[model samples]
Target chain A: MESKRIEQLLNKYLNAETTIQEETILSKYFTGLEIAPHLEEYRALFLYYAQSKTEYSTQSIQLKTKKQHWKWISAVASFVLLISVYAGYLYDQNKQAEYAFEHTQDAFQLLSKNLNRGTNAVMYLENYKTATGKVFKELN
Target chain B: MNQAEFLSVVMPFKDKVFRMAKRLLVSIEEAEDATQELYLKLWKNRKKINSYKSIEAFAMTMTKNYCFDRLKSKQASNLSLVHNNYREKGLSLDSKTEISDSVSIVHELITKLPEQQQLIIQMRDIEQYEYEEISEILEIKPTAVRVALSRARKTVREQLIKQHNYGIKEN
Candidate 1:
């Protein structure tokens, strides 16, 4: 195509007025082995576009691999979080049980001490009763 | 869709996604990060995405938003300059030797433009997206997309011509 025609097409391209066929023609023109000196600057841009397609860099793949590892790490972290929460709950329950056992033991100790004191008072009263009965028989 | 179905649907667009991210971020590393992030975002918001007419548009928008969010946060932290320099260094190291000098120059110039213009060029030129689709992805009027694209292409062409002359003079 002539320079003027190409320029016109380029203008149309800029205005988004070019049809797909025209775009394909423009792309073909730019990709041709021969390009004008003035239009050389645009050759790269068009060529880049023509060549621009989906590409995956090895580095990107590596990054993706690392991301996969991170997913596993995050999953593990979540599992650990759950386990920690459960352990904390179990710890609280054990503490409550221990507290209840200690209180029960204290209450039982208090009852046994009072029962022994009551028995000792009863024994002293029994000795006094026996001594008073002997004194009444001697008087008769 | 299920994971396999979603992956198959999106697998065809991986290059498109990569190019979009590469254009937006100007770094392969950042682009790769952005791609994975975009995919994760898609997976997270897959429910809402069913309403979208074009999954490609949806993915592109998500990628753009993610890149802008990172840029904004970096700016807010006052680390934009430092981060930019660091990114430049990384890009230099990871630059594709296969790409021609003109392509590299064009890519660099595109990065110099405002984000909106850059995005418009990418959508129209690189991705071959229609004006209506671009509008939907950008949430702008279709006319606005055309106008921005025209101005962006003009600027790019101008820059390319100037750079070409400078190179000839240097030679």
Candidate 2:
């Protein structure tokens, strides 16, 4: 295609007016080793598109390394958090059990004191009843 | 998406992802970091992504935003490193002779453009994304995408011509 036509197409391309097929044509045109001198500046831009695809770099390895480091750090942090929460829960349960045990012991002690007082009172009443019976027999 | 599905779709696009990062951030190291970060983000939110149409665009958008955030942070710190690094390595092509150095030059020039223009070039030329997809990715009207791309192309073309003329004069 003539340079003028190509320039027109390039203009259209810049305007986003070209179709995918037109883009392919432009890509092919620019890929040639020999481009017109005036249009040579655009050669790099189009050629880059035509020939350039993605390629992995050593930087990607670095990225992976950093990622792995962060992943481990995050995992460790989460594990510690879980452990801390579980320990807190266990501590709370133990405290509740201790309080319940102390309350039960206090209740038992109170019950024992009441039983001892009742036994003493019963003994005293029995002795008084025996005296009263002896006095009634004498009066008779 | 499941992890495996996400991996299958995104793994192939790593280089593209990296290139976009590199183009936007102007640093290989930072670009690699961005790519990994982008992937991790996508993995974390895999369930929210419903279709491929939005997936690629969303990834690109994430990359753009991430780069922008980095840029802003760098600026806030008053760190001269980012712009200095760009100046030092402006238009430096990789060691692949199969691709012309001019491509790198164009890429460098593209980096100097505003964020919107740079993104349009990335999607339309480099990624071969459709106009509608570019529009969606940018959240701009399709017509706006076309106009921005056209303007960006003209700018790059002018810079290339200037450089070419300088080269010819020196020779």
Candidate 3:
């Protein structure tokens, strides 16, 4: 009688019409030692299913914490990289400004020296003008 | 959710996820990698995890997609050399020791099925998910899941019986 029920359930299972409960019954029936010889061909298949269910991954699952830890570390590393890059850029700009300032100061010094030479020429001209005026007065 | 809460909720189904991955990828190591990848994805999207109705279904769907992507990229790169190697390795790994020769034949038969049928068998027969759950994970109608599952079961059955008959004749 039990074997008859098993046969029906197995048929239903093959047709994909069996409920989970019915399928469970069928799997349980196959696991037993007394499976009818005519039905014995399916024993390996059912046994495979049963064994397959036991195949939990022995590899440990790495939780989010460990992975998140890596995430945090990488984020910090990238942030530090960005900050140093920006700082180097700022330092370069400051150096460029100082260089420009030094070049301009040198340019101003050269211009002032030329102007002083021109002022000395103007002083010579003034002396010449005074000497000519005194000669004109002696002629008068 | 917080990490602890998310872990408590999703950890219970980790094995199921791994099994789904293994079924698709066929190599334990590949499956493990896929499982790890899936979990990392889940963790990254933890904020939206609760929005789904079934976390298990969502995780299984993710596993399926991720494994398929891996297989596609692998095929693109290696021309399926590693694919066959993994199938052989999986057969050997599964058939070692007390497992009979017939069992390995079933494993081979399973690998021969299409990806959809393979997943259906893995979930319905081995993992014993309900049709509703299978439908949700596969994003197919329940009737379609049943039809595919029935076809898969019948194919495995016919092939296994034929192999058994041949073995008996040889002996």
Candidate 4:
């Protein structure tokens, strides 16, 4: 009589019509040692299901908490700030060097132009001296 | 929600997520990684986490989709939907010795099942989810879930019986 009931429950179970309670009953019936020989094949299936349920993940979950997130964000932010600051310093240094170079070039150009003017005055004085010598020679 | 509250709400189903991932993924490490990834995603989106009707169902669906994508991706070339993690926990040496072979055979047969069928079996038989919950996770109608589950159960039953008979014949 118990076997007959289990057969009906198993049929319902196979058809996906069994309620959770009835399925539990079927599982219980299958797990027992006195299951009929014909129904014995299903023992492995039910046992496997029960065993599968027990198989929890052995690994622990590691969530990056908000504090950690902030830690990382701040770390990255500081690194970026450091890089940009160093880059700007390098750029400013370069610009200062460039400015000094241009001013030096202008000063040199001005000095050379003034020196050329003095040379021109000296050349004019030489010409005047030669002309004076020729006039004095003429007078002699 | 705060991280603590979010974790309190979501951590209850972490094992379920891992188990479902293990169902779809090949290795325990892969499943663990997938679980962690899913949780990280949920944690990132925690501001909107409470907007969902059921976070557990959402997580399961995400796990299923993530695992399927992983399986289809290029790295999944070496990965197969093999249920090799059927462990024998807390059982006596005698019973473990008896059921180990049959349990492994059932594990092999489960892996041989079709993709949808395998999910249905895992969700229904192993995980003991209701039809509506299974439908929600798999995004199928309850009727379709029932039909697929029935088909999967019948297939496993047929294959398992055949294997059992074959073993008897060999003995």
Best by TM-score: 3
**By lDDT, is 2 or 3 better?**
3
By summed lDDT, which 10 consecutive residues of candidate 2 chain A come out lowest? A55-64
lDDT of 2 at B43: 78
The predicted structure with the larger TM-score, 2 or 4, is: 4
Q: Global CA lDDT of candidate 3, please?
A: 0.89
Candidate 2 DockQ category?
Answer: acceptable
TM-score for all predictions? Answer: 0.72, 0.68, 0.81, 0.77
Docking tier of model 4: it is: medium
lDDT (10s digit) by residue, model 2, range A18-109: 98788877887788876777777777888766544554445432213466789999999999999999999999999999999999999998
Q: All models: lDDT? A: 0.78, 0.77, 0.89, 0.84
lDDT for each residue of candidate 4 in B62-94, tens digit (9 for 90 to 100): 999999898788345653324323232222322
lDDT of 1 by residue, A1-140 (tens): 48778889999987767766787778888989878777788887777666554345443322235667999999999999999999999999999999999999999999989998998999998988899989999999
Name the 10 consecutive residues with the lowest summed lDDT in model 3 chain B. B90-99
Query: Among all windows of ten consecutive residues in candidate 1 chain A, which has the lowest summed lDDT?
Result: A55-64
DockQ of each: 0.35, 0.29, 0.60, 0.62
Give the per-residue Cα lDDT of candidate 4 at B171.
100
**Candidate 4 on A1-140: residue-level lDDT in tens?**
89999999988888999988888898888877899988889998888888788877777777865777899999999999999999999999999999999999999999999999999999999999999999999999
